[model samples]
Target: MVAETTLRPADLIAPLFVREGVTSPVPISSLPGVSQLDLASLRSEVAQLVSVGVRSVILFGIPLKKDPIGSGASDPDGIVQVAIRELRQCFGEEIVILADLCLDEYTDHGHCGVLTPTGEVHNDDTLVRYQEVALAQAAAGVDLVAPSGMMDGQVGA
Candidate 1:
């Protein structure tokens, strides 16, 4: 049977990971054929994707340092921010860049929100951090922000 329609590379969003403090690409074993790339590799990777007609990419960052406040996530010079700036500069609005707003990637304890003294998640404090990250990403030319860490009211921000 013949197919009735076609889906092109431009029709989908490529999920890309950029890792700080790495000089080269590191393959994500759990996700075959996908890798966590450094800044230089990220530029090359996006170029390849663009050449293949990929028009959108959602970026996730793996910072060199993960602290209790997840400060790197909101840093103007953070990995994701730098990636966004580089992509926008090199690609010149040719791609739709989205930043993943998940705190776990930036948290030392691997939780999605700030931890209370009692080890409970503090929702409001987390929301403030999420906002900071979003603003920072926006300043870096991210087309969209995805709050995917399952924090309550995150999507509302």
Candidate 2:
């Protein structure tokens, strides 16, 4: 009790990994108890978290279809966007929903940014992609967008 630290359920932000086109939640052996959730499992897990007083969550999406431009990152019907809308409709403002804005998971090559003809990361081009992804997340009722791509000017842009 001597520690000057205060923690509550609100302070805990659950990180969810959601996979597109999955019929069931997939276990992530590397993450111990964590699993990549399908839409149904995601809803059930979030409900359980809310029942236990957790009021915040951030989502990462794994698209079944990855492209060079990571087009799914900004698609209104993308996995993350759909998940965000579903959560918002189910929980409304009772919980804070955040989206992890990045293209790595949606890119076939697993790079965080768009590539040049020489196969190098194109910074400026990737910024535009980030903007599109951010806008898409906003339109999906996300309370916050966490740009985890480690790109320069990501927050400022």
Candidate 3:
């Protein structure tokens, strides 16, 4: 088996949250030193991460708008897309940029899947949404996509 020592800076992937419309960083009480950063601040943060030993980052966007279908998730001008562009421009591919492929943050109900009329999670309908989100992230130039929704058939679908 490969030893832990084989791990290097390139193996580390830092997760960043880009929140909309907050000039200053807003600390997340549950996660210390992990704040919701705006675009400018996110750039600075990426710079800082690169200055250290990190060589990759995974981004999750907190959009300014939330809807039942989580439309903001796939928006080309969404926070995640903007963050990916900014980071690529700032780091010039020096860092591997990955995007979290999900809609929880963009959904007002806080559920990963689309809710049925009876308020139950709808899997098939959600898969369509996930596809859109995946395509959007790909269009945003994300090096990798991670779907964290734990939905069935997620890997194959």
Candidate 4:
């Protein structure tokens, strides 16, 4: 009857993967019990999380369009931005929404940032992209933006 540590639902932050142009939730082979959800599914899932006291969530997006600049990463109408807007409209302030600020999922080469001609990651260039992403997330009503990946000067940028 003596438990040294206690775990609560509120202590957990659910991570949700959202894919563009998907009609149904697609199961992730690598992540057990997790699926890439569509817009409708994402909304439902967030509602469920709030119902259970899981008040925080981090969102990752799989965009339908990818480019060298990963333009979708900072688009106001991007998948993550769209999700944030929907979630905010759905739950208001009942839940905290955090976006996974990265370009890997949105980049054609799967790199976290723009690459040089020799295929090297451009830290300074990437920082500018990160700034764009941060601004987009902030405009989308995201409670926080967690910069993902190992880009230099990311947190400060």
Model 2 C-alpha lDDT per residue in residues 1-157, reported as the tens digit of each score:
4778889898999999999999899999999999999999999999999999999999999999999999999999999999999999999999999999889999989999999999998988999999999999999999999999988888887
Residue pairs clashing, model 2: none
Per-candidate TM-score against the hidden true structure: 0.95, 0.97, 0.93, 0.96
Candidate 2: Cα lDDT at 102: 88
lDDT of 4 by residue, 63-114 (tens): 9999998999899999999999999999999898999999999899999999
The lDDT of model 1 is 0.93
Error of 3 at 100 (Å): 0.9
Candidate 1 global TM-score: 0.95
The candidate scoring highest on lDDT is 2
Q: Best to worst by lDDT, what's the order?
A: 2, 4, 1, 3
Clashing pairs in 4: none
Displacement of residue 102 (Cα, Å) in model 1 is 1.3
> What residue runs in model 2 are displaced by over 4 Å at the alpha carbon?
1-3
Candidate 3: worst-modelled 10 consecutive residues by lDDT = 2-11
Instruction: Report per-prediction Cα RMSD to one decimal.
Output: 2.1, 1.4, 1.7, 2.0
- lDDT by residue for model 3 over 68-127, one digit each (tens)? 989999898889988888888888879999998888999999899899999988999898
Number of clashing residue pairs in every model? 0, 0, 0, 0
Return whichever of 1 and 3 wins on lDDT.
Answer: 1
Displacement of residue 152 (Cα, Å) in model 1 is 1.7
lDDT computed for candidate 2? 0.95
